[model samples]
Target chain A: MRNEFHADLQTVSQLLVELAQEVRAAMRQATRALLTADRRAAEAVIAGDRDIDHRYRDVEERVCELLARQAPVASDLRAMITALHVAADLERMGDLADHVAKTALRRHPSPAVPAELRPVFTDMAGVADRMAEKIATVLASPDAELAAELDRDDDAMDELHKGLFGVVLGADWPYGVETAIDATLLGRFYERFADHAVNAGEHVVYLITGHPTPS
Target chain B: MRNEFHADLQTVSQLLVELAQEVRAAMRQATRALLTADRRAAEAVIAGDRDIDHRYRDVEERVCELLARQAPVASDLRAMITALHVAADLERMGDLADHVAKTALRRHPSPAVPAELRPVFTDMAGVADRMAEKIATVLASPDAELAAELDRDDDAMDELHKGLFGVVLGADWPYGVETAIDATLLGRFYERFADHAVNAGEHVVYLITGHPTPS
Candidate 1:
């Protein structure tokens, strides 16, 4: 019975890693859609979110089943609980990516981001993609050191987000209200995506070290 | 042993209700601060969030402890797991309210909503406060009927959120880029607050009826 429980725990970890991979693809595609005005890509990201949600519910049910059957204690209990949170964060990241896709869809044909601000968004998309990849890596291994590194990586995204504000509120601002709203919301989507990745990393760190990292 | 487990479950329920009440107060004060630009009220709301987080962690730890020790199954297991999700939603609502308060602080001595949009924000604040109060009531009783009503109540906030987009994106928008960005973010904060309230309501509905509401 103990071996069986450990096997189930391993399955849970594998499921989370798979979900992380899906989230990374969605985010990458969503960023590409946003930057290039690819309607098909945007639609695909929006449609793909259903799959992520399904995976999230699956992970959740499995966690509950494990708790009910094995009644895991101590570190084992924490692992199961942390899995629930990590899945939730990944699901939320998927949703944020979908939001970005919807923005692209809404402004179809004409890109939502202005040409001048394109570089900032491009940089943001790159950072967000890297963060998602790192999230997947850390989830698979649950390394405390690697998890802390994810937090530091997220700081770059935050700086990029702040720089967006400077461009929008600067004296030379040329975009109209509509574009301003779009840029602000778009920046937020990427920033929040990174934030959730950091959150998942913190959960991983907690699972490994038993020390909860403050968001 | 069964009686003791049931008693612990009751304590979990009571703790959740108490946390819901605190969330309601924080949201209410935060709204008031945003509309009135009350720095003191905003500061109070910001400071008060730590307490909410503490309560949330307390509830979570207790639930984990119960699951590990009692190995609750069937309805009992479902209730404890649902409690975790509901507490998380309440904590997020508190964070949204804090975001609103920070917006007020950022624009201190001057309201975040322009004079023309004040009435709209006033209506939103009123609706959000009412929703929080209803959430507390439904959580205390776990009534599926009351839980369903919260969704309809949220429709009004959604309408308000849509109306904000129309106002901001309208050709007659006289606000500058900074103000437009502020208005957009502020509108989203309120909309998301109501959305989280609805999510909490859905959790209550599930707890009572065992039917998961579509998120």
Candidate 2:
């Protein structure tokens, strides 16, 4: 019975790792759709989110069942709790991707953002993509060091976000009212995406260290 | 042992109610600080958020401890889970209040938004305050009817948010970029606050009826 319990634990951990990968892909696809102005790709991201959500519910149910049957202790308990949290974060990340995809669809016909702002968004997109990937790495390994590095990546994302907002707000731009709203929402989407990545990193640290960072 | 378990459960429920009150107060105080351009009031909101955070964490720890100790079954289990979720929503609501306070501080003195748009904000603030209070009531009593009423309040807040964004984005305002960004972020804060309130209301219904609303 004990051996079977460990086997189930291993299975749940592997599933969490896979869920993180799916979440990472969803984010990447959504970012690519935003940067390249591809309606088809954006639609795909929106559709794919349903699968992610379904998978998350599946993991949640399985984890709860494991807890009821196995009654995991110590590190095993932490692993189950961490799986529950990471599933929620990954689902939220998928929602963020859907937000980006929806924004991309809204701005499709002629590129809603100004030409000059494209580079800033390109950089922002890169930061978001990297953050998603790093979150996956941290989840897979549960390494305290990777979690710390994810914080640095989050800082870079914040800096880019600040720069983007400054350009939109402080600089003179000719993008009309509609375009400006799109740009603003897009920047917010990226900022929120990075925030969730930071949250995932924090969860990883909590799982390994048993303590969350000071607020 | 069972009596102590019941006592702890009552404590959890009582704290959850108090958390809802603190969250509502935080939202109202933060928005009032913004509308009045009171920097000191905004600072107060910022300081008060720490207490809200502490309360939420305290409630969460208490609920988790109860679950670990008593291993509640059936309705009790549902109630505990609902309390856990309500705490999370309340915590996120507090974060939104903090964001609004920060926005207020950034736009102080010069008043980045147009005086004309003040009424829109005023309307949004009123709706948000009402939503928070109504949700708090529903959470305390676990009333499906009141929860449904809170959902209706969300509609009013949504309408105000949409109108404000339309006005801000439809025309070229004289305040330049700060006004637009401020308006956008302020609209986001109210929208997200309303969203969380709606989520809390749903949880209340779930706790009472044993089924959350359909997504």
Candidate 3:
């Protein structure tokens, strides 16, 4: 009976790691859809979000079942509960990606971003991608040191986000209302994606230390 | 031991209700501050969020301890787990309110929103306040039918949001870039608040039905 309980716990952990990778792909896919102005890809992200949401529900149900049947204790209970929180965050992150995809679809036919801001956005995307990867690693290992590094990367994303906003808002080209809306929504998507990544990192710290990071 | 366990479970339920009420106040106070541009009120909301966040963590920890110590079954486990998710959504809703308050600080003395849109915003504030109240009520009594009604109100917030964007974007006034930014951010806060309300309603449904809402 004990061996079966341990096996169930292992399955839950494996699901947590898989969820992280799924979220990372969704984030990348959503960004790619935006950069390329590909309506198909954007639509794909929206549809794929349903699958992510479903996976989150599935994982939660399984965790609850494990708790009920296996009666996990202490660290095992904390791990299951952490799994629940991280899965929800990951699902919301996917939803944010879907928001970006919808925004991209709304502004399709390739409305170009200002050249000056492109580098900032590109950097933001890279940071977002790396944050997702690091979150996956943290879930797999619960490494407190690695989780602490997420804050530095989040700061970089914040800096790039500000630059992106400054360039778009200060532009002289008058790209019209559509351009303004797209820029605003896109910036928010990136900022929130980074925020959720930071949240995932916090969960890792909590899982290891049994407390959330200080505000 | 069983009697003590039941008493702790009752205490957990009471704390869950108290947390819901506190979050609702924080949300309403922040939104009112935004509309009135009350800096002190906004600052209060900002300071008060830590309290909500801290209390949320406290409830979560207590719930975890209960689960570990008592090993609740079936409906008891469901209620506890649902509280965890609902508290999270409530906490995030508080954050969205704080975001709105900060924007209010930035846009202080915001040129009076045009005459045509003043009532629209008031209507929005009404819907938002009511939604927060309903979320609290649902948490206090998961059996209430009011939660389903609140879920429908989410669609009303979306409709009002569309009207807000149309009026602002369609206006000829330069309104400048700042108005555009304000409109976008305000729209986002309202939408997200509604989304959290819907999440709370879904939890209520899950509590009664033993499953999450239908896809």
Report lDDT per candidate: 0.89, 0.79, 0.80
Ranking by TM-score: 1, 2, 3
Identify the superior model by lDDT, candidate 1 or candidate 2. Answer: 1
Error of 1 at A168 (Å): 1.1
For candidate 2, write residues B1-215 as lDDT tens digits: 77887788788878877888888888888877788887887898899999988998798678666666676665676676677778878888999999998888887865545787899888888888888888777765667888888777888888988888768766556555567777888888888988888888898888888886876
Any residue pairs clashing in model 2, and if so which?
none
On the 0 to 100 scale, the lDDT of residue B138 in model 3 is: 67
Clashes of each: 0, 0, 0
Q: Which residue window of length 10 is worst by lDDT in model 2 chain A?
A: A170-179
DockQ of 1: 0.81
TM-score of each: 0.98, 0.94, 0.94
Q: Can you list each candidate's DockQ?
A: 0.81, 0.42, 0.69
What is the per-residue lDDT of model 1 for residues B1-215, given as tens digits with 9 covering 90 to 100?
88999899889989988988998899889888888889999999999999999999999999999988898988898898899998989999888888999999999998887887888888888888888888889877777887888888799999998888888888888878888898999888888889888988888888888889865
Q: Per-residue lDDT of B30-79 in model 3, one digit per residue for the tens?
A: 76777677778778888988888888888898899989988987988887
- State the lDDT of candidate 2 residue by residue for A1-215, as single tens digits: 77988799777767777777887787778877777888888899999999988988888778767766665566666666667777877788888889888888887865655777789888888888788777777766668987777778878888988888777765577664566677778888888888877887887788789898655
DockQ head-to-head 2 vs 3, winner: 3
Ranking by DockQ: 1, 3, 2
Q: Give candidate 1 regions above 4 Å deviation.
A: none
Give the C-alpha miss distance for residue A210 in model 3, angstroms: 3.8
